[model samples]
Target chain A: MKRNKKMIIAFITPALVTFLVMFVYPVIRTVIMSFFKVESLTASTSEWQFAGLDNYIGIWKTPIFRTSMINMGVIWLVGGVIVLSVSLLLAVILTSGVRFKSFFRAAIYLPNVISAVALAIMWIQYVFSKKYGMLTSFFRALGLDNLAKISWLDSDMKFWAMLIAFCFGAVGYYMLIFLSGIEQIPQDLFEAATIDGANKMGQFAHITLPLLKGVFKTNLTFWSINTMMFFVWSKMFSPVETEASTISPVVYMYNIVFGTKGVTQRDAGRGAAIGVTMALFVLIIFFIFNRVLKDDDLEY
Target chain B: MKKKVISAVLCTTMAVAMLAGCGSNGGAKSNSTSKATSAASSAAESTSAKSKSTEPAKAEGGKNLVYWSMWNETEPQAEVIKDAIEEYQTESGNTVTVEWKGRDISTIIQAALDAGETIDLFDEDYQRVGQQYASKCMDLEDMAKAADYETHSVEALPTALRGWAGSLKGIAYQPYTSGIFYNKAMFKEAGIEKEPATWTEFLDACKKLKDAGYAPLVQDDAYVLYSYGFQIARHLGQDGVVDLCKNGGWAESEGALAAAKEIQSLVESGYYSEYAPDAYPNNENEIGYENAAMIVNASWVPSEITNNTKCDIEWGMFNYPTVDGGKDPATVANVGAQAFAIPDNSKNGQAAFDLIMKITTGAFDQKMALDTQSIPADPTNEEWPEMIAGCKDAFNALTNVYDWNMGLNTDADLKTVIQDNLMKLFEGKMTAEEFIAAVDAASK
Candidate 1:
């Protein structure tokens, strides 16, 4: 017993130390920084002025920051619904003894394997381009001039265009998760359901969904975290500058912290406050998911 | 018992491996620090030796100078710099170690400086070097005066540098002016004999171009603020524009509404292309393809368009047309430059300044301008690149230069608001009044 405990301690120590240094310490520092007036990220702690809630209040009052928050919220709620539904549907279809299941799975999961930056560039340059774009060409070919004329990268449509592209890339990863969760359920339950005269839809509704509550909660939590940290797609869509239509909280934080071409004021404190706000958003979602989807009593 | 022994061996190996990884990093860091220390000491010794000797005493092995550059290794400018470095080494008996840090150098330079990195000299945008990293820079006033830098370099550039940095902190290497970069072929095709000098003439030119079945003007979304800001700056000087952006009284500003209305007329008259303010490099590319006649952009646009589209274009430039009753004259234009600065922590400031002078003046300046299709920093090197040759007159006529975006981007919070509404105004989605009202409301 003594030897086993000693071995465990020895094995865990490195990881524990790494986690404390890399993750926990940064988290604590960021939270503390949110309350201070830190102009530069490299500024010494001695130079920090205690601003209390001023940064938080200032960030909220900034119109661009508020726009970013709304944009994030929309991406989270709307993108979550589309991504979850599509991914779950694909997961179900793939697992229903479908033909070419492996090939289909690989095809769908390909995007997740690609770099988000490259994927976003592909979307922006090829798909959303007004001139010589795939969508424009396709719509024009179909004699849909009105649709063809729509500038997909315009301010009004850019956000939705980015969301659709991001969601398209995200579906594959979540589908794989759903696939694993679905595959874990015993075959006997489904056989029993079929034997009890439950149709395919009925079986899915009563057995599959109820059993997958835990997976749904997991996916929701992951989605919440991903959405909170959303940056790359927004950045790619607005490559030269941050647009009001595509700005997210993280991008806003980046602009204020690191400074962009147009916006040169670096406010590390406000950036920290934005970071804290995003963390709280993710935490609140986690809490809500835990309370709403109780998976403890659900048997495998 | 055997499994336990294997597990113990594996764990011990893993621990050793991790320790070795960390130890290697520490060793490398220490090695680099010692090297830097030696380099500094050598430079100091050389400086002392030079002071004592009538003839310059070259170190047995040349003293090292580290330079962090904003250009990529593959860029033509970097190629010119590399060639200049070789020439400098042979001429002055000094070794320059250059790290091509690329465009993100601006974002990371401060951190590197703060960390006490052994950076002797670095180059970035003149405005950025002046505004953001002024304290990190060595005051170059004495060196500049001794070298007669103001006489050698573009007159306005050093003056502009002083305006930003409050003293001579850096010297411009590659100066550029922002104006209307247009397709000269399109101008000839439209029978526009002369480049527009005022707002009415500009509108007449636009009409002729439109009548010739061409889009008169095109702007990329990236440069919408710059284009609009120039118009506003023509009305109210760059300072007034900055004040308006910082403290939002756009509707009440003397010529803010007038500028908006002028831009609105352009929009209404179909001066802008169908996709006027398309995403960056898109609308600019249109000019190369002959889909558009002109774009209000920096002198770099022609090179960018050519590089991206591989299209041959007869490019010409003129200053942004003067607005009627504007505060600033046509002479007041937007000028910017890339500059070299010696770090405050540099042990070899004189050597770095010498290297900067070598790269920026005489033959090297002309070489850089020719190779990179950029303006020559040295006024003595009068051979302008073919594409931007027309910019020389406008550049020379400049009495004052404005900051990037005419200082409208001074306020971080309001930049997005101004940019968004400006885009809307250009797209004809919002009227001039609505645009002013929207910006003013956002300010409050």
Candidate 2:
């Protein structure tokens, strides 16, 4: 027993110390920073002025920040629905003894393997390009001149365009998760269902979905976290400056913290406050998910 | 017991390795600093030995200058700088160690400065160096006097730096001005005899170009705010525009309304191209493709267009034309420059300043301007690149330099709102009244 304990301690010390230094320390510092008026990120604690909830209150009053929050909310809710449904649908189709399943899976997941920056550029420069864009060419080919004329990168359509591109890349990962969940449910249960007069749709609705509640919850949690850190796509869409249509909470936080072109003031305190807000949002969503999707004691 | 002993040994090794890694980094930094010092001393001795008889005054060898540049190694600017550094080392017996931080220097520079990093010299946007790092920068007034920089360099730049930071904060290099960079071939094709000097003449020029079956003006979405800012600045100078942005007087400012009405008329008259507010580089490329005649952009646009598309555009530039009853004259322009600064914490400030002078003046300045297709910093170097030769008169004639977006970008909160509405105005989606009202409400 002594030997085992020694071995465990010896193996875990490095990881524990790293975790404390790298992750825990920064988290604690950021949390404390949220309550202080820190102009520069490198400003010493001695220079920090205790602003209490001022940063939080001030950020909420900022119109651009408010716009960013609204944009994030829309991306989360709308993007979540589209991504989950499409990924789930693809998961079902792929796992239903489909042809060349590996090839199809690889094809769908290829974008996820590519860098988000490169992927975003491909979408912006080619897919959503005003002139000679894929969608414009497609629409024109089909004699949809009105649709062809629509500028997908314009302020009105940019958000949706970004969302669609983001969701397209995200579906593959969630689809894999759903695929695993579907594969895990015993073949005997499905065979019995088929024998009982439960058709494919009925089987999916009753057995597959009910059993996949845990996976759905997991995917939802992941989606919520990803949406909270929604930065790259938004940044890529508005490369030069943060646009109202594409600005997210993280992007807003980055701008205020690191100082973008137009942002004269760099308040790391407000950036920390935004970080804390996002963390709270993710935590609340996690709590809600846990409560709503309670995993039952089901015999596999 | 054996497994535990092995694991204990492994853990101890890991901890020791981590500590050693950190120690090595510290050691490396210390080593570099000492190396620089030793190199300076050795060079001093050698110079004294070699030049003692011929030039006793030049016997004191050069100091090592640590320069953190904003350009990557592959960039044209960096190549020119590298050549200059080599020449400087050969001529003055100075050692310059340059770290190519690229654009990320702006973000990391403050932190590095705060950390008391041994950065002898650095360069960034003049406004950023002047305003953001004002207290940290060494006032170059005495150094400029010693070097006779006032007589050698462009007067407007140093004057602009003084205005920016209330002192001579930085030495300007690679200076550029934002104005109407136009296709001269298109101008000739449209029967335009001369560049427009006033708003009415500019509009007439636009009409003729449009009548000649060419798009008169096209602006990228990224530069729409800048374009609008130039128009606003023409009406209300840079300070007035900044005041309007800071305060909630946009709806009340007659200048703001006039500027908006001018842009509105441009949109209404089809003076702007069909893709006026297209994404960056797209609308700029329209000028390169000879589809558009003019774009209100920086003097670097021709070079950028040429580099990107390899299209030969007969580029000509003119300052933003004077608006009717405008406070600012046609002499005022939005001029910006890259500048070198010696940080207050720098140990070898004089050495850094000397290196900066070497890079930014005389033959090197002309060389940099030609190689990089940038405007020469040294006034004495009048052999401007043919691509941007037309900018010389406009640049030299500038009585005032405006801030980016005419200081409309001063307020972070209103920046996006103002830009969005400006785009809407150019796209004919919103009227001038709506723009003013919208921006005013947002400011409040």
> Model 2, residue B5: what's the lDDT?
75
Off by over 4 Å in 1: A1-14, B1-62, B90-93
lDDT tens readout by residue for model 1, B103-143: 87877888878777888999988877777788778999977
Angstrom error at residue A254, model 2: 1.6
Model 1 residue A8 distance off true place after TM-score fit, in angstroms: 6.0
* lDDT tens readout by residue for model 2, B236-332: 8888988888877887899999999999999999998887778777778888788889989888889999987799877899989998999999898
Cα lDDT, model 1, residue A17: 76
List model 1 lDDT by residue over A186-280, tens digit each. 99999999999999999899988999999999899999999999999988888876789899999999888888774556899999999999888
CAPRI-wise, candidate 1 is medium
TM-scores for chain B, listed for all candidates: 0.88, 0.90
Residue B229 lDDT (model 2): 89
DockQ for candidate 2, C-alpha atoms = 0.54
